[model samples]
Target: MRSLGVAVAYPDPGVADELVHAVEAEADLYLALDPARAAVVLAGEEALSTLGEHPADAAVVGVAADRDAIAVVARAALRCGAHEIVLWPQDRAMLRSIVRDAATRARIGAGRAEGRIVAVAGARGGVGTTTVAAMLARAVAESVVVDLDPVGAGLSGFLSDGAEPTLAAVVAAVDDLDPAALSAAMAGHAAGRAICAEPREAAPTKQQAARMLALLRATVPVAVIDAGRAADDAAMAAISLADQTICVCTPDVASIRGARALIAAAGRGFPVVLNRSARMRLSAKDVARVVGAPPVAVIPDDPAIRRAGEAGRLPSRGAARRAIERLAGLILAEASDGS
Candidate 1:
């Protein structure tokens, strides 16, 4: 684990050294004059008055030798963003535990700074956008599939069936979502995790959708969003927030034209995935020229895919499965490289 930048604000210099040494290996513990940059800040009761104001997000700890003094100092520290209060000497073990936990979380958060939110949008219906998104999600270690298509319900059945909390419930409380709440809301599948959106039901605003995606990426390795055929504000918000936007399309005339228009609307440099290219009207290169975007992946048509869907199973082996796995690898590799 990487070390965390911890700041100790104590009146007595000797006591500060003791606190710092307790968790030195886990954190680059020091007495910080600037509390803004520290991941965890230990504020003694007497020193609490010195920290006028600091970042609300930083984990602040109140330290005091006297039990009565800890309560008094904690109340003051709370106004300055103290999340934990501990009595010194008596609570040294607990204090070290808290600091170590905070340091571990800080390291995790820093690592998650590279998390990617990829949006898979279809030019028109039946282009296998949801399938591509789900497959790519399954490739990643920790991934969440957000089904923004209210009508398709493809994602709802893509994963393992369960009566988990729906996306609607999560959107209702978008302003107050925690890690536990989000994990509970998402339905588990053998392939990966999914949060199915309600049909024809509008709950999350565009801003809320952005926040939800951001939170998901913060918690998970990747967030694969199936933005369906809907071009609503919420869907647009998802595309806007995505680290990469992939437009899925077949090589047919209508699919090509629709894909071109969707890519143009989405903005320049957005990649396209030529899916179901068995009886194609044009090649991947031609499709790219027409769409004005390069083809990031090409998934061949396969009857086994349909059979797997009917059997409630993902394609275990075949050209389509292999292609999807390759596409998933490409997407994840690109994300890793960029990060």
Candidate 2:
């Protein structure tokens, strides 16, 4: 593990020294005199106001002396943009854990500027969200497809030819989530691809879901996640952490209505992809108007898709593949623009 650069600020030198002694093995301790250079800022309740005054880019962790004082300090810390608040002595382990996470985030964030995460979620079941996600993963170099759909066919089965450890093992090691751990958990597939999807038995917790995405993003250039129908906590976590969330829907009234509701609930700027079926009557324009955002990409009904699925092969070339590639380009463009 890389050493975390932590800035310690407290009213008493003895306390700061004690903190340094405790974390010195894991972190590179620094005085909070120059907060701008620090990855994480640790401040006593009294010194919390100083953090606000400086307004550094580092994540702030406020320390309170005891449980009784923590509530007041926590509110103040939050108001001052503190990432977390810790009760000193009582919550030492928790404090260290938070600080370590903050430091890891800071380190990974600085290393990569284009490791974008694109999550695909279905407005309703059977909307081809997993297909789109797998296609997008194929379009991107050094990409991984993470399946958060507990009930759906695993991405490994749909996309990969080889088998290895699944996401079940990864979630089991959530506390040690990193590039190496994720790589070990990932299953090898054809065409130089990797995927992290396991059986439903090893579903991750909400925090684990978020951590999985964060750590995966640190290693790969693009992470294409099939978030399924958002019926579970892990799916919800994937949606929340995604850089770009693509809601896939058919052009039917029910699908459009569900997509619209999902888009509204997902907040502004999340794009929708219209997957046209053979029995579709509603136009792309109608779908867009209902969803409140112009369609980013459209996939028309293609028998090639069905044929490929039946043959247990991904669509290599066809209208469907072309459409998915176009959608991938649009997602890449958006990621570039945001970066």
Q: Write the per-residue lDDT of candidate 1 for residues 124-156, one digit (tens) a residue.
A: 999998888887787777888888877775776
lDDT of each model, Cα atoms only? 0.74, 0.73
Model 2 scores a C-alpha lDDT of 0.73
Regions of model 1 farther than 4 Å from truth: 1-37, 51-57, 61-71, 83-114
The sequence of per-residue lDDT tens digits that candidate 2 reaches over residues 123-153 is: 9998888777877888888788888886774
Q: Supply the TM-score for candidate 1.
A: 0.80
RMSD of each: 4.4, 9.2
- The estimated TM-scores of all candidates read 0.80, 0.66
Highest lDDT: which candidate? 1
Q: How far off is residue 288 in model 2, in Å?
A: 2.0
